[model samples]
Target: MKLTYGITDKLFVWFFIIVLIFFGTILVFYIDLQHIVKISANIVNKNNEISAASKKMIENLLSMEENEKKYRLLGKDDYLNYFDTARKDFEGQLKKIVQMEARGMAISDNWKNLYESYLNISPRLRDLKKAQPSKIPWIPVNVINEWIEKIYIARAENEYEVYLATTELNRRGQTSARNGLIGIGVSSMVGLLGIIFLAYTTLRPLRELLKGIRSISQDRFSEPIRIRSKDEFGELAGAFNEMSVRLKEEEQMRSDFVSMLSHEIRTPLTSIGESVNMIAEEVMGPVNDRQRKFLEIASSEIGRIGNLLNHLMQVSRLASSAIKIRPLSIGTSAFVSECIHGMAPAAEAKRIKIEAEIPPGIPNMMADPEHLKQVFINLLGNAVKFSPTKSKVKVLIEEDEAGTDLMFSISDKGPGIQEEEQSLIFNKYYQARRIRGHMDGVGLGLYISKHIVEAHGGTLWVESKIGQGSTFGFSLPTAGK
Candidate 1:
């Protein structure tokens, strides 16, 4: 049965070819090395034997020349016997060289020819002892040494020939090995490219699938993913498209449910609050201390519920992109004063001082007055809530670094946020863990404020350390800048 692999397994298998190529190259080099070593040994042994025989021939010739001189000086037949023995040795060495020459070994032809000519003069040299010294044809040592010189010259030439041959052989070996390595490298490179191409055909579908998955995680349900193959990846793509359609439907249902519920709850909450107010004011009847306290608790809970409902409605509107901003030119100092005035009662209740460092004659900003005030109220409220009773909350208004936007920062001497939790604090329904004490919120305040600031083409961020107080700041573009 044929087996098919997943993209991962195919990748693993394809990459394994690289490792195999490396080992294959090593094996090829080793085979080449063995061939070279064998050839080198055979050539070296053959050349060494030829060189030794050539040297022995020259030595025997020199011995014969020496014995001839001794017979001339001492007038002894023993020298002639010694000279004959040396001649026999020279012939034996020459015979060996002739056999080697027949077998195509590199022996010098000049040395062999000279030895043959010297043999022709041998009958004359034997008759030298029989004649008187004057009749010996005045045999000079130069004549005898002349043949020895020829042998030496021939031996030197043969040694040079062997060196040149061995050097040529070594050069050829290196060239062969280099060419082989280059061939392997080129083939390996081509193979690697082929593997990459094969892997790409499989990985393309996976890349698209991963992108679609990321879009889904980001709540983008309308993004479509497609794969051409009828394999497993193509089927997964089909299933992914179906899931997107279902998720989009589910999101629509959720928005509809929230809108309907918010409207239904608001009317009863207003009526209940009015009724509680009348009871507390003795319009209906005089109330006892315990009854008044219960009324206060009921009133507080009703207000909390109203705030939560408002937050939910705003979130729905924001999600649906229904909120509109009617930006108007508003004075900076005036904006800050209005925000402070609105939150003055709450700050006073905690006895927390509100400090303002408004730069005089600050530039006006283009922003929705209500939304802008809401952003400040949310930030200032948090500051007031988190600050100690006697500590101060400072609001600083200045031109931003770019000089094109006015920056507003609310800093509090409250327990700061941790570094790791900084990024999560702006997320919807996310509240940081309080180190000093518990701070309460549904986590929607920062979320709403961030959107509001972003709607004005600005940004909101926080800077804090563990012990140092936190500064929450935002920048709004100046009017007409």
Candidate 2:
């Protein structure tokens, strides 16, 4: 069978398990305490019973002795026999009292000491009856009376002691029960609060994550994920934010690629259509050698579109592995000089002067050489296109305490980019709206150069102002020793 459960459900299940274990242990402690309380009550009751039996035995002995004296004074045989029978009965009761006193001894030490004193003095009173002295000193009777009095006093004392002990034990038991109940009550409240907090805290993030996932499923990459948590949920939110940024970039790239494709294809189609119209109207009269030049130019424009498409496809492949740096030590000055030399022909054609400044002690960089070269070439090419006739394009290289870097400043005397468009300049298909002159190629050159520079652990940014000039610069990291 297949089973499914949500994350919150699982958390609740574990929470219940923990609570169950905690309460179960408390319940066991409560049961054990109850048993102790019951044992204490039984001990107090047994001691009270021993005290009552001792009182009864003392009363019987006193009644039997009075009967013996009355029968002797009257000289009645039947009364004497009754006294003898009562004496025997009293002796059996005394033994019973002694056994009961022994039982009281087990309950508490005070009861045991009192019981032993009573047992020792009671035997002396029994000897007084056997002696039959002429003067009958009455001291024996007084002593017996004194022993009985003491036994009664001890019994009363024992009863009082047991009563006090029972009161305290009961009080202690009640206090223990109250405290345990209070503990359970407090623990229950705290557990309830903890469960509520756990549920609400976890559910909030889960709801946000669910909403974000649903929005992403609908291709809404622009929506921001709103999750604020300090735990793993915060990490998940960060991951989602990164994913949204990547998707947004991909959508922008797809849109730009489609727009560029239409523009490239239509430019060639328009020229081809114009050429066909001229040939059909006999405007060139059977297409002479000079007339064929127009056809050649139109065909070449179509071929140029094909070449641009091919180069763009290659560039797209290279951009797939964007920001994957392959670091290697490369001479800074030599690399910059080579880039300038390679693009010198184009610079010369535009009548743009090139200035190279490569200091003797400039260090190398750990970077992708080919990507760095592409970045310099793109910057130089832009300078060549925008610079006025006889204007200079400067390439400077220098090293500092921070790092060794080469700055290629391509300043143009032409009307520069607007302040607002500077940020969007690196964006694909985001051409400067204020750029007046017609420029060839889509705005992918600077964008591609920006990605390449960043991949080599560098930064690309333009310092430009309208109608003044634009100087684009990039920096790279120096190779570590």
Candidate 3:
């Protein structure tokens, strides 16, 4: 029900489509070229033929004048006949020049005017010669010469016009060819880039999907799908990633439940076992000095059981979202120092020197003081428990921009946690098994601290080096209305 394509396939499709457009454009230009060339050639040929006819008309008109002069001087009929023949030839050519003007073939306005003037005078002069030959014997010859001069002027104008038309036609033809070539070039480049872009968009998701599959095979389900697209492939990747996360969460919850249950049952049963052993040994049988000691040890073990149960209950309540937080203004620096001091007895027993470095003018934070105190006390207590004898435990406070907030850092000079275990440190009941026998409490201090800090709109995390020491820090919001 879904369609997906790789980058190369997408690119190929785009390129193929572009090729179609390019070829279509080339065909269009080819047809345009053919039409332009045909029209241009026709215009040039027509102009050249008109020029030739105009030049022949001028020659014939001059010849007619020469013959008329000879006939007038000698009174010869043969010369008169020659003059008539040349005259008829000139008139026929002149008519053709007029027709060229009517057809819109590069004829000038001045040329048309001159031709009109010659046509009007020629007929009138011929009639005058026939009626008054004795008084104006050479009138026809004079009119012929005048007409020839006018015809020459008109022909010259027409020739110049034709030359201009020819030049312009060539210029326009060249421009059209150049534009067509440029269009072809630009379209081809655009299509190529479009293909490349389409291809990259298609292929990147497939690569990401493959990499995700490999990571899943290695039992790593934390990497979420990062591909952002509107296609079916993107939707599939997102769905698969969501499923992976849900499964991982379910599996982790199952493991945590089993481990916590075992620990809960074992702790109480151990306390009851120890108490029953003390009674069976007859240590408290007579209810004397040894009896008192046995009762004391049993009481202490019972208290330990109660503490363990309380911690388990706290984790369950926090995980199930049963706790509600009420925020109030409290001095951050003072509170942090007090929590550190409260753990002084434990540090003193380990011979660890505890110190607080609270700066002046620290901001007050908005949070539940009791919850924040529990967070700080748990961190400080862990520092005291793990620090080597005579080693120093330091607490530092500072603030910065982005909002008024408090940063409390507790550092301990003890064997630091391994890098591989750092990420799981805040997970519920995730104790470092290697150091479990050396400590007296379950590994819920940091987990509970993380929950409380987050509930107060803060963050908690740890930084450590294997050989040097470990630092636990948290951020709390500044005081506000």
The best candidate in terms of TM-score: 1
User: Candidate 3 — worst ten consecutive residues by lDDT sum?
Assistant: 128-137
Q: Who is ahead in lDDT, 1 or 3?
A: 1
Candidate 2 lDDT over residue span 1-481, tens digit each: 7554445565777677657756765775677577666657555555566576666656655765666577557745565455546545545645555565455444433335545654565555454445453332222356446557766776777677677767777776776677667767766776777678776867787787888876665324436667665566767888988998898788668756855775677676777767766774578777777767776776667666765664465455544553456778998778778888998899888888889877787788777877677777778888888777888877766565565555545666667888877877886545777653577767777877887787776788888887777888877778764
Which one wins by TM-score: 1 or 2? 1
* Candidate with better TM-score, 2 vs 3: 3
lDDT of 2 at 373: 74
Candidate 1, which segments miss by more than 4 Å at Cα? 1-17, 24-39, 65-77, 91-157, 173-256, 281-293, 435-438
* lDDT, each prediction: 0.79, 0.67, 0.73
RMSD of each: 6.3, 13.0, 10.2
Instruction: List the candidates ranked by TM-score, beginning with the highest.
Output: 1, 3, 2
Q: Candidate 1: minimum summed lDDT over ten consecutive residues — where?
A: 136-145
User: Which residue pairs collide, candidate 3?
Assistant: none
Clashing pairs in 1: none
Q: Distance (Å) between predicted and true CA of 103, model 1?
A: 9.5
Model 3 C-alpha lDDT per residue in residues 218-310, reported as the tens digit of each score = 333448878887666678789879878887788568647955885778776776867666775667765667766876787677767766766
